[model samples]
Target: MQQIDAKQAMAFVRQRRDTTDPTYLFSDLDRERRQQAFIASVSHQLKDAGTFTDIGKMQGVLDAVSKNIVVDSDLNLIQLAQQATSLTGGNISFSTLPITGFGTSPDGASINTVDVKQVQATVKELLTPVPLAPVPTTTAIPTAATTSPAAPASEAAPASGAAAPAPATPSAPASNVYADSTGALQGGAIACVK
Candidate 1:
């Protein structure tokens, strides 16, 4: 139930070794990267005291995570490790936050500056669970507009010898998906994402 911070590690290193070398070792890493490292370290520690011998190790790390980790229950750990591995699309949480732009510091030590609030806000957005939108409900009512032509402008007079305007060919229905094998489908039809 104890929290470990980079500052604490730095302090310990400083105390034991009597030097500040630890702080300088990984200070170049940005906030997101550092946070990611922390999450990964913690996740590994939980699995086998700093080893990844579990089957869900990769999937666990790829899921979203927050700086604040809750450990009262193993499953209630999305804040520290997202568990919806099936939907993660093979993404990981330890990635670095995008940089606003590239520039040099006053002291000439190359640096990547990020807005503190913006970065945290973005991280929160990633951690929050999004409700799946309700699929639009529509009756599968059949209509003939696509099958039948416009009744040839009912009652309109035709010009002398002008070949009756060729009946317009029915256009292809929109297909959002394509299948390798066909099943009970006509040449053209509207397909949803499903």
Candidate 2:
């Protein structure tokens, strides 16, 4: 892979050429993947090249990007950068929302068709925090001297005839939305994109 400057990076991310090539970007989703790849590359490069540690390089990058990037009014760039310092290249991953199929719009423009319910479900799954596995507990066995006399099964049963509630089960892991899709992009390297 070749190193690219900001201008080349912008062009690479924005280009919509080569629709016929299976490996190249043609759809809006492909462009988004390219954009995500670019961001990952830049983030990795910034950390790899020690740009964050170098005030001059950091200022240069800020000066260049501040012109093109927008942020909330109260966002502190320094604080954000500080926070970002803890994020490694491995921390970044990107995936586009799943699309059903391609369709022609009323205006004859091509569009990706998506299932709204599936999208909602996928989003909900992505947002829901996974429950942590229960820590293994050790129950000490009582010695014969310490153990109480065994009670009859009927006596141990609740008077109301209700059974004890079962322990809650952990939710299954989220399904990978990108498993059958090509829109997944990972960080830590310069990903080839259209």
Candidate 3:
């Protein structure tokens, strides 16, 4: 639940650029160009960012740059944001929703696109927990207990020639864990023309 301001994020992007183009202000880049450049730049930086979350830093990079930041969560987002900022030091987890497609705009601005329907489905799948293989455990098997006969007619077994049914054993429930398709935090290469 951490975020970097657009200007600072862009600064990181600029530092990572390998362009041979003439030096120019970051502002000079078109919106689409800035986004493309940012993605290309940070794709590698993400890996080296290191772990900032407990258990693990779930790494996720945006496929496209955003001009605004929104605090949306299962809990009161504003309260969560305030609490997060108030902490002197806290863990950060990165998560990404990637593009499923890409195309150029009519204005010649390179654009990255996503399928909203597909994304909705993917989001559900990504959030849903999966069952981990059950760990095999062994326990003592039950032994039949001996009984003493008191010659009580009412307590004696029925003489209908029927046998008693054995008891049924219970099984343990399957263990479930969240899915981690991205594997580990690592730098990835992005191809682009300066």
TM-score of each: 0.26, 0.59, 0.28
Q: Give lDDT: candidate 1, residue 24.
A: 40
Candidate 2 lDDT, tens digit per residue, 67-118? 7664334434565455455555576657578999989999999889999999
In model 2, how large is the Cα lDDT of residue 185? 31
Backbone Cα, N, C clashes tallied per candidate:
0, 0, 1
Which tens-of-lDDT digit does each residue in 1-194 have in candidate 3? Answer: 23579787766556633366658433323444555545444433443453212113321222121123321122333332233232222222223455755578999975668788877787776556564445556586644533444456556674498774344545433322334443431122111232
Q: Point to the candidate with the largest lDDT.
A: 2
Task: Please give the RMSD to the true structure for each candidate, in Å.
Answer: 18.3, 11.2, 16.6
Against the reference, the lDDT scores of all candidates come to 0.45, 0.66, 0.42
Q: Of models 1 and 3, which has the larger lDDT?
A: 1
Candidate 1 lDDT over 105-144, as tens digits, reads 9999667788888887876665455544445566777588
In candidate 3, which residue ranges exceed 4 Å CA deviation? 1-10, 13-18, 21-95, 98-101, 115-117, 131-194
What does the lDDT come to for candidate 2? 0.66
Winner of 1 and 2 under lDDT: 2
The worst-scoring run of ten residues by lDDT in candidate 2 lies at 185-194
